[model samples]
Target chain A: MMLKKVVVCGVGLIGGSFALALKAAGAVGEVVGLGRTQASLAAAQQRGVIDRIASDWADALHDADLVFLAMPVGQVASVLVSMAPYLSSTTVITDGGSTKVDVALAARQALGAQCAQFVPGHPIAGAEKSGVAAARADLFYQKRVVLTPLAENTEAHIALVEHVWQACGAEVSRLDAEDHDRVFAAVSHLPHFLAFALVHEFAQRADSAQLFGFAAGGFRDFTRIASSHPEMWRDICLANRSALLVELDAYMVELMRARVLLAGADAEGLQAMFDTARTRRDAWLDGLTPPGE
Target chain B: MMLKKVVVCGVGLIGGSFALALKAAGAVGEVVGLGRTQASLAAAQQRGVIDRIASDWADALHDADLVFLAMPVGQVASVLVSMAPYLSSTTVITDGGSTKVDVALAARQALGAQCAQFVPGHPIAGAEKSGVAAARADLFYQKRVVLTPLAENTEAHIALVEHVWQACGAEVSRLDAEDHDRVFAAVSHLPHFLAFALVHEFAQRADSAQLFGFAAGGFRDFTRIASSHPEMWRDICLANRSALLVELDAYMVELMRARVLLAGADAEGLQAMFDTARTRRDAWLDGLTPPGE
Candidate 1:
């Protein structure tokens, strides 16, 4: 199915890449950019990520077959409220929000009956860099895109979102909104939180420079996510706080166990844990499609 | 000053790379390999990481100008005790142990008066892959090699160690043994522990498969160190337990603060911490020399 006009709100890495991917797939005729900044929209247009920049929700949703919300999670409620009146019945809405439950709540509260059109999604792809300049058509290639369909969403509307993600070279799967948030809080948000906390702790130390000076490849990779967008991660942490707290507490228990092992010099126990982690991680890595293939 | 002969114990990634680097720099005449396994030593010899596989400490240390102990931290004490009888008065010794204080103690207990000849060092360079096969002549190129010299170490002996690391294209810096352990416990060891704990915690969960399936780039990098050599890390953690425990406890405090911020939905506080972390990490990354230069 071809989308004659697709409106992408945000015009940054996620939105711009989505627009470019759809155009490259020859599945979208025109991509309209809508965002908080006209300059960023102009940047997306210049980068060929969007065919045009929309000045208002009225113009953006006019004849739009799909509307993608790709902004930070915290902005979803207000943006949905602003665009709700302009959304046509046939215009299926989806999002690239990392947290699904919060975005689903925002859509339900804002769109009311039209929330049926909103299929909450999260594309499991990112880079160290962000913004329109970092956007690439192949960003979603071989990546996973999870959809958390609301009870109000019709099969056809959910299928439309799935088709769009598939057309962009992504593998699509569905999960309940609550399950989506909980799983991601355990896998994604919790790790990001730990990384940020570790880095921040080191940065606040008196010998931070000396400590960082000795940090090598392991330290580099382990804390790489600490370099992610602060406001974006902050929103995610707060949005998925309950699930994240559960993860954080579980992790603390694990760390405490590790400390006990270290304190008692339990070499066998520590090695067992590390071995299990490595074995599982290696198996998962082996199952993945290597990038750039 | 070129080495007439160099003996490397435990010819794995760290030791194998050192032999190769020294050979590439024409800093040593002959390299002798000594390890617990003859098979690995033979493999190192076949890869040209060592000129010969020595049958004993006497065979390895005979006429050797330097002895480089590159074994796991747990093996160092026993190895030092084994080699102490063969060590000549002028044979300056060094190590690539990740922990300094423990290695220092090992040297003192095993070598006694000969401890002055041992210059404790840690090369801040590593890859996800290990073993002699993964060794490269350029492994230490542009990397940091920290020397934690003993009070009894003569300036000339310490200079010889520094010059050798420099010949391998490393920038050598000196820190007190105590300071080295403390700094590295915070920067390097703590991050690895956290990564391993995070991965192990998830791997043990009932929903492990689901959580891992939804995991993305952030999770990948954050837990990359979880795939490290389990035995090696266990030894490092145990050897440097005191300092690592301090760092780990401090990090838990930081994580607790983060939890409070999330629980309270204090968006401003969470963003501030993330901002600080990202800013510091970005600056640290900027100051690093780009690899392969």
Candidate 2:
């Protein structure tokens, strides 16, 4: 059997890491990296993440069986539509965008019947750093990657995408685009929003540097996501505003309850609140116990 | 040189760990553990965290030049006042309490002229787990142990406490209790508050089990503090409420602004907000690039 030819567009962190994973799994015969920056394309090739580099998108996709649009979430639509001119009807298109609803919608409008081959995906793995320079082959190992497929999606197309993810060592789950958005809004978007809000608030405080100086490991890790790409996050928050807003309100109500309990010096009530949380979260930890290798 | 005799009261996590640190450093000739529980005292001695277990408070203070009271902030003053009956005028006492302002004042009212000898200290090192069994010799290594000593504190007393921290491999910083409370309110208490709020908000969502399943590394680390000792945290939140409430107000204001920005889909404003936080916190990461061991 001939190996699949894989093309990764916008060879930054996500795209570069995916290319590395595909090559490592021996699932792809050759990886072609296409990035806007000529220097970045060279960097990706130099890192051995890709066998070849293409400065132009069409050149990279010319003989590829799979094309991955790993650009910023906001840029996924326009880039996908732009690639429409060079796309073969048989080619399988996939994305690793953070926000899925918009990307899934874009696939429908841009590719229509061909959208059956476009699998919208989101891998819940990242570091604060960005670009191809920060790419690692094992970034997606043991991570959860959610796929949002419409009724138009064919089983063969889904199998091809699922095979790639399995080869990359990801735990794959399928859900509707709207459900994906709501779920991610709680787990991912709210966290990023809180992280951004926290550090930004401290930056504007009088003793900003000193405040950061006193910050220990917990604070650093908690706020690390605040250091992610602003352009990407801003697009994510706007795209999924209603869901994010609801989670935000829920957090506020809980916080005020704790605050009021503290104000009254109700030690018993406060301890009970913490006890309940610890019990619930401990159950979660036990379920995923020992962590995946 | 003769090793100093040291007594650690309430041999739970903090006291047991302190005794272990002191004994490991060879700073104490005889490390004695005193607590309310017989099982913990037995574990402390069996683990070599203490040379012997002292069942009575008066007996524990007999030959000690130094004493460390490692109890909740709310209980620190009463314990000191009771133990004062048997303490020698020259024997210096210290505490591992979270809030120094109240403890310092309590020392003043209870210890009177002996307040100069009761140094207020807090070691900012801990884990989710507590008890004598969890005690380790290296717990305080490379950790910060802040001392809040008043003007009446004699040089000999302050130096004695500083020497103990140095022996335990802790970096010691001396600051006024009020400033200590203000700084920690932002760095420690506020993060706990936010973590508790987040866990309560999302961990109780409709699909909490799945959200917990997909929670990434960052989320797990950020929320780990929510699993801390509830009774202990209740005392921390209440004793330090004045400073913590201020920090809470500041955070809520920032959250309000973030809500408006997200609600209005203000892309540029949100982008700027995230960008500034990224630059600021990334600088923190750069500045504290961990020193080679």
Candidate 3:
């Protein structure tokens, strides 16, 4: 198979790693990197994520057969709009955004007929660390990469995007944009919110001020997500507010029950609450209970 | 200083690691292992954790200058009562129980005047993997091992317990038994409950029924504690039910507030909720936050 010329915007962990994965798979002939920081672009270039460094966004996009939006989720719409005027008819565009519906709609509004060439994609993969320094060539291997295509999605464009992900060793799944948003809101967003809320609650206590040195392995594991980039999570929570609200309601119902059981000295009730959760989690996590519980 | 003879009852992660650490630090002349399981006793014996594996508990208690109960929280009281007849008048008995108040009170009831020699200890260090195989000489390095010295605690016994943990490379902090219960309940128990509960809730979803194939690094880190021994956590929740209840109640308050904000589409409230937590965690984690947030 002939290699496509691919340009990756943003040289951070997600983008840089994707760029390396494509290079490792030999799916791209030449990779071009665009970044706001000269140091990051230089670092990515030195690491061979890109065959050549681009001086500007135009330099990166001009001859590219495929363009990847690996920047922040908030930056996706604006960058897509800016790239449309220069995009070739043969060029295909895709994004590595966490939230898809907003990005997909933004592409429809901004690119119009060009939306047919844009495949809205999100690879549910990343490390806790950031920056190009942490990039790995096999980062996306065996990970799930979801694409949300609109009614106007061209067959050729969808196949091209799937080919790109498959070459990167990802298992591709196609789903409606709205369903993608709701599922992720439950699986991802609500978890992040709970992590932040729980950590904030602990940090407020007088006991935390003095005796928190006693918090061991479990405490650290559960609250590690609370230490994520605030601006990123803030944007996500705001963008996915509707679906996240539903999950928050469901969770509160359970929390309230636990509260009641505890207050009533209902050891039986507490045991019931704990046992149900314990048995279910144990079964699910051990692969005995099928997913979606 | 001559090496102290220490008898560690229950040879597993905590006790076995404690023995390795003491031996490494040249803090012990002889270490004795007392356990109900023959395999664990054999492992501890082979690993040099105990100079001898006790087949009879009373005979093991005969020669020890100090006794450390490293058994499960639920079994601490019964063990104390069983060992009371074997304890020497001059020996100090301390336990490494996670929950302190009940164990301290139990020591008082079971040991009577001998209770003054008993100091309740909890070292805030562990790995998800347990058993003698997980034991390490540096397991407690730079970690806190809190000694909850009750009003019944004597100066000599407390000092000896503090010296033991310090020799194991732990920074020792002293607290009242009840306060120790309250603080750990918030930091450790509540987080474990939530992880178990969330996993159970998600298990019921049809989408999750397929497989948890899309789990990311964040999900793994957050739920790593969910894989802990269920019996251990069950005993903890049961032993420290009151304090765990208080923390769970406090947590639901925040969870509800978050739900309301998400439901009302109050983006500002949502941002503030996340921001307060983000800023608070960042500041506290980065070691820049004021004493109270």
Candidate 4:
């Protein structure tokens, strides 16, 4: 097989989906799931996301060709620290965290001598659904997977990780960790925060029920991301705090300008701003293939 | 026929769709379109949205039993003033403006004694697409249509307008003009403004192309309204300025609080806010029938 044994840490949506995709592509002989909870690991096994469960990092790393860390950002550091002693010199490690800088630093501190083997990555694919039950073999099909390799990583290590992603039908691209954090903070994290904030504001109003009853498809689509897993978003917001703050500031300034335009009944100014955004968004959407294509 | 003749002003997506729906339900004997431009009127007629085009409001109102003022909020006032001189005492008039208060005042000032026949309405249905080309007979099927009747409007006039909407497969409800504006300001106008502002901000960034390239489906859906017709939104924002400004202020306060929470790494606070929002949004979604159902 392309890989003799693959261990997927935290076998929920991301980790479980990756293992299933790799297995479907015949890229690995055996896939073992590693998680603290037996219930989740059992569920992952039942879903065929992993062939078996690993009791601990020692068991998970034993003769494992690759390890994919797909846990919450908050837990990635601790897991890496615990797995450091058991990691084989030949084992290549990669991650699927949304935020990369923190995870990269975690690897540097936790892996120490073996840091070069750990390639930090983020698969830019997901659904609103979560957990092992939501995992699918073709979750990564035609999706983008971004790798933010550490300075210590060797060319061979990066290639091996890229090969695994390609086999799963994902297109691979490389960026520095900081750049990845900034880009995602603006495009993904900031939008989630805004959606959540808008929903929260509405929920706190006295006429929330009446207002929500009047809401149609537009409000539903705009706030869909607010339905994301709470703890996962919380961790992402905290982990990528600096970059997210900058984006939020930029968004706030734009909002303030719009408020002024509306207050003054400046139709020309408002239309110009909207026209620019509409033109840009339409052009951007035209270039994208629909999801799963 | 339920109505002898119907005249629809503006003849864009909203107007065209309403005319088509009424025609499909066999509620009107003849449907005439009125617009400032001949091109849009010709297009609407070619698409069978209307039976014929009127060179002026006077010509359209010649023998009409009902008239639909389905123009932008900014144009609604001027159209009402122009049509007032030709409006027959028996003609029941209504509008599909996003804001109700301004339209109510406009009808009062423009129609004079005929104001009793004018019913202000806001139909809560639309697509990102616009124009007569995007019109569909079922556009208002299962959609909510809120009517904010003026004090001068006779019960018979309101019922006639409601009957027409019911025949078109829309659920009709009543609200005060002021209340309708407040509710829609929070739910629709504010959200559209926020989306436009976000997209506008991103477009102005130096790395805009790269950043937009990384945006996913969630971003696309959340900002879909940003691609709405610019002049249309500008008019709505201005027409409902007072109510919109109140909602915008509340939204700004919420955004500021979120910024503080993120800056301070308040995970517990952030999670609590997100959880509340997620629970509410999920509940709201559960109540909605999927689109086109």
The Cα local distance difference test for each model comes to: 0.91, 0.84, 0.78, 0.91
Cα lDDT tens digits, model 1, A136-253, are 9999998989999999999999999999999999999999999999999999989889989989998998888888777778888888888988988988998999999999999999
Better of 2 and 3 by lDDT: 2
lDDT of 3 at B277: 68
Q: List candidate 1 stretches off by more than 4 Å.
A: A290-293, B290-293
Off by over 4 Å in 3: A1-4, A24-26, A29-60, A131-138, A204-208, A211-214, A264-293, B1-5, B36-48, B51-57, B266-269, B272-293
Candidate 4, B1-293: lDDT as tens digits:
38989999989899999999999999999999998889999999988899999878788889889999888889988888888888888888999999999998888889887899999888899988888898899999999999999988889999999999988899899999998999999999998999999999999989998899788877987898998989889999989999999999999999999999999999999999999999999999888874347
lDDT of 2: 0.84
lDDT of 3 by residue, B1-293 (tens): 33457888888888899999999998899998887798898988987888987767677777678888987787888898888998888788888888998898899899998898898899887765678888899898877788998787778889988888888888888888888888888878888878777776676567765435455567767877766555566667778888998788888887787777766767677666666666665555565332223
Could you give candidate 4's per-residue lDDT for residues A176-262 as a string of tens digits?
999999999999999899999999999999999999989998898888889988988999999999999999998998888888888
Error of 4 at A12 (Å): 1.9
| Chain B TM-score by candidate, in order shown | 0.97, 0.94, 0.94, 0.97
lDDT of 1: 0.91
So what's the TM-score on candidate 3?
0.86
- Candidate 2's displacement at residue A193, Å, is 1.1
For model 1 chain A, the run of ten residues with the poorest summed lDDT: A284-293
Give per-model TM-scores.
0.97, 0.96, 0.86, 0.97
Query: Which model scores highest in DockQ?
Result: 4
| DockQ of predicted candidate 1 | 0.85
True lDDT of residue B101, candidate 4: 92
Q: What would the DockQ be for model 3? A: 0.41
Name the docking class for model 2: medium
Worst 10 contiguous positions by lDDT, candidate 2 chain B: B284-293
Model 3 scores what on Cα lDDT? 0.78
DockQ of each candidate relative to the true complex: 0.85, 0.72, 0.41, 0.86
